[model samples]
Target: MEIQNDSPVNPKQVTSAQERGNPADVAQSGDFNNSNSKKKKAPDTEGGTAKGTILSIKLAPATDLWTTLKNGSVKLRMEETCCGGVSPLTVTQMFQKTVDLCGDHVAIGFKQEKQWKTLTFAQYYAECRKAAKSFLKLGLERFHGVGILGFNSPEWLIANVGAIMAGGLAVGIYATNSPEACKYVALHCEANILVVENANQLKKILEVQNQLPHLKAIIQYKFALEVRQPNIYMWKAFMKIGEKIPESKLDEIIDSQVANQCCTLIYTSGTTGVPKAVMLSQDNLTWTANTAGKMVDIKPAAREKVVSFLPMSHIAAQMMDIWIPMKFGAATYFAEPDALKGSLVNTLREVRPTAFLGVPRVWEKIEEKMKETSAGSSALKRKIAIWAKDIGLKAGYNNMYGNTHVPCGFALANSLVFKKVRVLLGLDHCTKYFTGAAPITKDTLEFFLSLRIPIFELYGMSESTGPHTVSQKDFFRMTSCGKTMDGCKTKIDKPDELGSGEICFWGRNIFMGYLNMGEQTREAIDKAGWLHSGDLGKFDEDDFLYITGRIKELIITAGGENIAPVPIEDSVKSKLPIISNAMLIGDKRKFLSMLLTLKCYMDDETGAPLDALAPTSVVFCHKNECPATFVSEVLRKHDPAFYKAIQDGIDAVNSKATSNAQKIQKWVILEKDFSIIGGELGPTMKLRRGVVLKMYKDIIESFYVD
Candidate 1:
């Protein structure tokens, strides 16, 4: 796909936020000359190819992230991109320009000590530079991985920029990973100098430091109770040492940076087993940042505002929170990590950001809250909501002449109903809201559409630099991952009779491949240059790609019919308001079954997390016990009303399935929810199927009578 340098940000008014929500607002400017590129066909419209888009890329450098080759090749060789016109500066140099333009502007905000705290762009830049100087003083080498372990924070941002600015690699570790998992990353990545948040992280690192052969110094951020150690240094003291470094040294490091070098290592969410560090180059990052902004019609220099609530350890968040802002001058606000469940909505309301990104879960929680709220409200409020929602659903599919646009009555509907909902949900200013990192149910997407809030679904993994495909702004297909992103070409390798195949991706967007694991890297990306994403997908006649399921995850039943579990599982979750996770379990079995976990059921009147889930909704027994016995014993203990509700939810899901092989035949509710700390979920909240299956092996086996 191709996009032109059509809508450049007005240099005269650099302060203006690109508030236009529609892509059509930015007219096509530069010529689309690439013969391979497809042209604009509506997202849902069949049989037409979108005219191919040709985008001019720029080279930016912020070298070496995590995981090193440590091989004979001192500098890794990779294919380059067609970067047109101006040669972009290193990431730090471009950031310096951004700092100059967005100086004194409120760049970041977060809650601290029960009050809101703010940081200006100028101040943020200064902190990053100071932190860089301190890293230099500590004798950090260029391209050395400076491991960072923390949630999203002002200090984390500063340290990341600072490390890269000082010509060192910035490596982020998931704050939720186990001590063993943490040790694996630190050692494999070859990090010596590490920065961590608070005492809990420090405690974890200290426990593993003896095992970490390369680790030497540790820098600690905020702590209510300080821990003293020989290698530990307070953040304030670290910055003070920066004053001793020569100012010219910092500038010299920036000048030496090159675009083709590695920038960061974004580890894949290893659902099957151990994660591999995917090494992304500076050009890979810069290209993604530049194209992402263009895809959503966000101006490169415009001061767009966005929420940074997702983990910085994840690639999507890295693009949105770090790279997007640095490339586009977008103001990013950090929501208190602990309070994101309760406080993010309020923060978003206050920020009223133009750009919003969320996983399906985040959107579902908010959507569920609205449903519960509407149920308890007065008659008139309920009627108005029902009426407004009808309008919204229509507006979502409303075609304005040739262009697909929101129904003309949406403004009226919004003023009457959706306006209040948007205000309450804190999305009044959200123009481009994206959902990815996981598949969203059709019901959840429809829920947002029924609310007249455009929540577009995109598809990508850390291997593909976050977004490989994105739904067009106004015209989008809820069931699809949308059109291919600019600079990306997709191929469905050996499709089945049903047209589903393993999604293979090519172009400049693919990563430089896995670090150290040569065999794995070669397996993932062919010498021909196509990165085989294990996802089973298909392109519509209109070229909109639809992700079906993962190739390895397809369940072949006893009847020999293959089934996709995600859709069935997603269906169950959407049908059941309280269910947080639903894993289908019928591999080599008679029929499909599921293991269920609720998201702490809500109180009917108060809309709060219910303390008791009708007392018997959960099955309780020994870990080794059979599921049938567990459920029987649990049922003997209390009223069956709760079980009936769960059964009804299961039935609802089964009704949506097209075939008997696809429908869930039986299920069991687990006593606990799948959690990251529990080793059932990755840091990105993706289910670790192997871990979950092993942990509940007994529960799964009991589904069949033996």
Candidate 2:
């Protein structure tokens, strides 16, 4: 895949060696050049020993070298057995073991047709076993792929787990995927069975089924569906056939599973080109859970509640909702896919969850809502809020990193201001919140931190199992992604004056390799064992990792200056409550420009009364107001502390940018937010850059015309 440069830098133009820093001189020099070519001695066999060679700084981007090292370790790690030297088991085995141990616990909760339903651990296990038995009964061979097409439902999880249990690799088809996209993955993986939730999902599969020669059967989880094809079977009827087998036989099949076995085939949501199917082994996932558990030191009994809403198909959600909770024996409350607005508030109130995970967009929305409420309060109430916020910020910062003991005057602020704010946001029951999957604005992070809500920023990708780094409650840098997780090695590939480069990871959690795409897999995981995370990042003096942006996403201006769009977009979006998505435009242009999409909170008719509810007489425009005005109002209400910061950002871009690249010199506000259903976002809620560019081609073109 070609890395598109929207900024100033021409990707084809490589940086000269003389401009780069020597790795030998840095304090983390050993970590930078830990390639196998140097023949360095392995570290002690003890768990904490740093056996791998330290990285050596190099001038060129170290993508190829890192991939080699990571591939080697992926093989080695999979070969190593866990659970006291029994035959090595894969991630699927670990999941099955947990279900076996806790069959009666609540495993999944969801709303089916507007009624809440739940699956006990035993029921969940039984369903998976049944599905697996059905697959095996249908003669599905080991390593064959099965595609699952559905929304968030218990059946989706059951089919996913069943695919692995049956010794077939499971591939997920995003519920929101187009028929063509689904066809691409099914054909690419050469899937044998397609498991779908309902007739609607089945239809999409049918559209592309003719193109897939390997497809042997289609299974529908829902009953009473009209399917004329002889190859299609109802989920209930298929399970009945599996039920004929003795229970002990199913248990035996599960026990015989091994760690190196292929389990999941996840496709990367790359911004450009066809997605690559990532092949992950059971060992890869289990090791990831183990390493992540050690890093966070999660207590099963203490912090048990998690509000799960992110798509399970995404690796981050799987880690947070499935693996982490399973390992910790924690309870997770699933939210309805359509009820995110009300379900979020209701779930928190009902479950009083202690931990939750969200993408930056979710938190940004929360911040916007809070500001909207605060916009028209009385003068006296505003004064009280400001005072309370100050006290809360001080105490919150201290409490976050373990400095909960409030000083004399600070105690007054918490009682008067901060405490109320927490109650207002319905976050009074939360201990901490994890934000990841995309870059979060510093202002948004600080605002929650100030409100005494512990927002711990984390970073990772599908290829890495899940999160590789998370900020410790008390020890966090505003600019950093957090320290590397335990059992993982991290370093920069090439250094500029800022000591930043492509972030490389060598750890037990890396995936086995991409599925079926040997050349691509080899390219991603080189001969060594280090995974080349394409993210550009830098380390501070304290070793905290700060992600700048995707190396491929960096924009080079016509002035020869490279600008990372992530930070800039994050900064702009954080301050603009009405804006949900913002893409930086103009590479090789004099300056940066942007295309901003407004987040639709409520319909104009539904929200117009809110403006009347406000004490101020500011007129409500018909969703056609200047984007800048809407953004300014949002910043003024939500983040009063960052007024100067927001102004500075706008001024900097305006002054340095050429007419084309200048600070969105002319822009339009999108009437709706980007969403998966809207075809503007991917399943993980990541903006589809190409889709957005195409959809808004006219608006973008208008900026340069006359």
Best by lDDT: 1
Model 1 agreement with the true structure over 22-72: per-residue lDDT tens digits: 111111112221222223422221112244433233323212221236221
TM-score per candidate, chains pooled: 0.83, 0.79
Q: Model 1, stretches more than 4 Å misplaced?
A: 1-89, 112-115, 399-412, 601-611, 614-652, 655-658
Give candidates' CA RMSD values in order: 9.6, 9.8
What stretches of model 2 exceed 4 Å from their correct place? 1-74, 78-88, 96-104, 111-118, 222-228, 247-252, 376-379, 400-402, 405-428, 574-577, 602-649, 652-673, 702-706
- Over 204-301, each residue of candidate 2 has an lDDT whose tens digit, in order, gives 98888889988999989875677788889888777766766666765676655555445787788756667877666666576676556545556644
Error of 1 at 618 (Å): 14
Best by TM-score: 1
lDDT of each: 0.70, 0.63
What TM-score does candidate 1 reach?
0.83
